[model samples]
Target chain A: MHEHIQPVALEKAYRLLNHGPTVLVSSHHDGVDNVMAAAWACALDFAPPKLTVVLDKATKTRELIEKSGRFVIQVPTVKLLRLTHEVGTRSLANEPSKLQDTGVELLHLAGDTLPFVAGCSGWLECRLVPEPHNQATYDLFIGEVVAAWADDRVFYDGHWHFETAGREWGSIHHIAGGHFYAIGEQMSARPKRGG
Target chain B: MHEHIQPVALEKAYRLLNHGPTVLVSSHHDGVDNVMAAAWACALDFAPPKLTVVLDKATKTRELIEKSGRFVIQVPTVKLLRLTHEVGTRSLANEPSKLQDTGVELLHLAGDTLPFVAGCSGWLECRLVPEPHNQATYDLFIGEVVAAWADDRVFYDGHWHFETAGREWGSIHHIAGGHFYAIGEQMSARPKRGG
Candidate 1:
């Protein structure tokens, strides 16, 4: 059921991140893994979809992501608010691994390349685009998205249907102090170009 | 009336952007000025209040912002949807800049250093922190916010009061195709660390 959603076009993958939901950065390397929350990420480019996420130098996820040159970002729903806070606050270094620290279930990709949190609304597999200067100076890393997927029940046909019947998937955007604002009330504005 | 709002502590300023609203990047350089719509920006650091915004190399606003080394990000309200469309569509390259392209009432600081749209609920005045690698490779510009302000009616004492009486100043989050989701209900998640 999790794999039912088809891959999003690399170009359109930026849309999944367009609205700025807080994401859980997941990565694995050499049998070691890490996960952490990051609100400092945004679409860096459109085609060949690229994204920039800040990972502080002192994080276990940063070490794992840098070592493997790949990572996955997942948009968790409000239902995972407790888990989000749990995973975000604790360091993998303290517990030796995220898998042991929390009750969150993880699904490893074929060949055990990287891990993705189960029950996430959206997920993107990305390979690092090396930018050492930004990484060392700002703790920022750029990634070129190679694969993308989302729960079709929540996103499909290039649009998000949080209102779809029997579908209650809504992306979570963390504000401050463990507070989150769930995506709500979709409305469209006509393109002002044809005037 | 958009002039005065108590200064926000730099570290806490990220809270303002943590929710992820599309912002209007307003900048001026050598007497020329421009404003463009941007949904690709996020709070990067806490202390010293740093932010990262993706600016297309082709955008006139990017050129002006790069030259000025200063830009103000204004968080527009839902009431400015038409103005947002107008600003997003019209480029600064052609005659009549976004300031004039849209009928937005401009509010300028006394020093003329920072300017903001009158209807916006929050504003951040940032000084560029040059990261040439990210800029040349990814068109990402990093800025350290020096001063920040917010409309007391909507944001006071670091909490948004959109639920208050008389005025409802909801922030706009851009999804794609000029479509946006007005910021909806606020929900808080307690710290799982202590609880």
Candidate 2:
């Protein structure tokens, strides 16, 4: 694990994905480590944090997740924009060195066998909540987050510091084609007038 | 219907939500209408665009959706920040005047009774694709987008011009509490290196 990486409380894990950002999905199965970028992931629940990510049937990452029943969803930074696109469009099914060719590096967390993509500001280690119907029909898979971590510099004290952190640390949201939008200015809604 | 609002092709409707933004969900049933803010909405599929939103059982909007089997998911702008938070937190079940008190204005399109938040940048009218087990277990609802529209000034040519449009036109993404980050600078990934 990177020096700056720190564990985020399980209750606060949902905040990591609350703001919709493109994420890198990684999994390890049968000695195979695969990573892919997903734009359709969203936080599903807060307590005992859970999330949903749409994984196309064609991706090797999805296959790994199906076999292992575990995967990691990580928040890719603006700095990883091109890498994210490359991983999302290209495939390990055709290219044997998809991860290496796309400049993806994996970080292992001690005894955990799941592969975590490096350079992400936050990560949620998930256990697949099998839903055969949803998976086969919509390519939608649900995962219950068992552990979570984030870089102290970018996400500490229970919330994102994108406003104070370097721009490179900002999370990116894919628009269409190869275009994306890095999360922008912070705005706070006024507190209740009369509760 | 606002003159600036234009119909978005069904095939291209997914682009409206491709970049994850907190959405305002509105529904109508019997003689009642309701709207609520949701950060858990995500694009589920492309063709015949489908989406998933987690609606807590407590929300009046969810009840309206359950009875009507229809809803509208619209992208709330930075300008609707306070209104979004207010609608999400206040309940029509308790506060009968929630919508009016929160300054939420609605725009109806011809025959449709589903309330569309007036200032939203984009709107997707959906018909519920009922999945009983998922809804009962997860409070997750899936909808197939039957029609869509976007404000031309901000979203035209099938893409968002948030960078060039007024900052307030940008879609807002909730992080936690009432804090949010507006969709930021546009970044394009480098073109594919090779086939």
Candidate 3:
């Protein structure tokens, strides 16, 4: 792990994904490692943090996750935009060298065999909460976050510091077809003024 | 509908939420209408679009959705920041006049009874898909978008025009509490340069 990487309290893990940034989902199975970009991941619960990510049946990363029953959902910074899109478009099934070709450098978190993509603002290590109906019908997978970490330069004290972190550290939100928007200026709402 | 509000193609409706903006969810049942803010809504599929939103069991809007079997998920703009936080915090169950107190103006879509917040950038009228187990266990609700529309000034031609739509029109993404970040700069990746 990088010196800047720090563990996030499991209780506050949902905050890492609250703002809805496009995430990189990585998994390892049978000596195989894979990563792919997903725009449809969302925080599903708070305590005993759970999240949902839609993994298309076609992606090799999804197959790895099904076999390994563990995956890492990482918030990729603006600097990784090209890498994110490349991994999303290319398939590990067709291109066996996809990860290396896309310039993905994997970093391990101690004892875990799960592959974590470096340079992301945050990483959530999740154990697959198997929901067969959702997976077979909707391609939706649920995971209970067992552990989480953040690159404190961009996220710390249980919140994201995108404004202070340089533009390259901004989390990217994908709309479609290689297009994305980096998270922008922060605004605070006035306390319960009415209603 | 406002002059700028135009119907969005059903196939392109998923693009409206692909960027993951904080949305205003509204529902009507038994002569009552209510709206609440949700940061956890995400597009589930395309081509007869489907979406998922987390509605706490405590929310009155969720109750209405359960009874009526329909709800509207609208992407709110920066202009509605205060309203968004206000509604999300104040429950209609306790505050009988929550909508009016928060200055929410409910607009109707032709014959539809669902209340659409007036100033949102996009509206996705959804039919509850009724995943009872998931809803009960995870407070996760799935909705298939039946009809969709977007304010052409901010979103049109199947894309978000945040840069050209002015700052106030930008989509707001909730972080936690009353804090949020607006959708920022638009970016496009250079087509497939790597392996």
Kindly report which residue stretches of model 3 are placed more than 4 angstroms away from their true locations once superposed.
Answer: A191-195, B192-195
Please write out the lDDT profile of model 2 over residues A74-191, one tens digit for every residue. 9999989999999999999999899889889899863578898889999999999999999999999999999999999899999999999989999999988899999999898966
lDDT value for model 3: 0.93
CA shift of A186, model 1, Å? 1.0
Provide the clashing-pair count of each candidate structure. 0, 0, 0
Name the regions of candidate 1 deviating beyond 4 angstroms. A109-111, A165-167, A191-195, B163-167, B191-195
Which residue pairs overlap in candidate 2's backbone? none
Q: Model 1 misses residue A156 by how many Å?
A: 0.5
Report the Cα lDDT for residue B120, model 3.
94
Order of models, best DockQ first: 3, 2, 1
Provide C-alpha RMSD values for all models, in order. Answer: 2.7, 2.2, 2.4
| Model 1 agreement with the true structure over B1-195: per-residue lDDT tens digits | 745555677767887898888888888788876777899988888888899998888788888888888998878887887687678878878755457657767667526855566777888889999878778877888899998888787877787666562324777778788777776666676744665
Measured with DockQ on alpha carbons, how good is candidate 3? Answer: 0.88
Spell out the clash pairs found in candidate 3.
Answer: none
Going through the candidates in order, their DockQ values are 0.78, 0.88, 0.88
**Per-prediction TM-score to the true structure, in the order listed:** 0.93, 0.97, 0.97
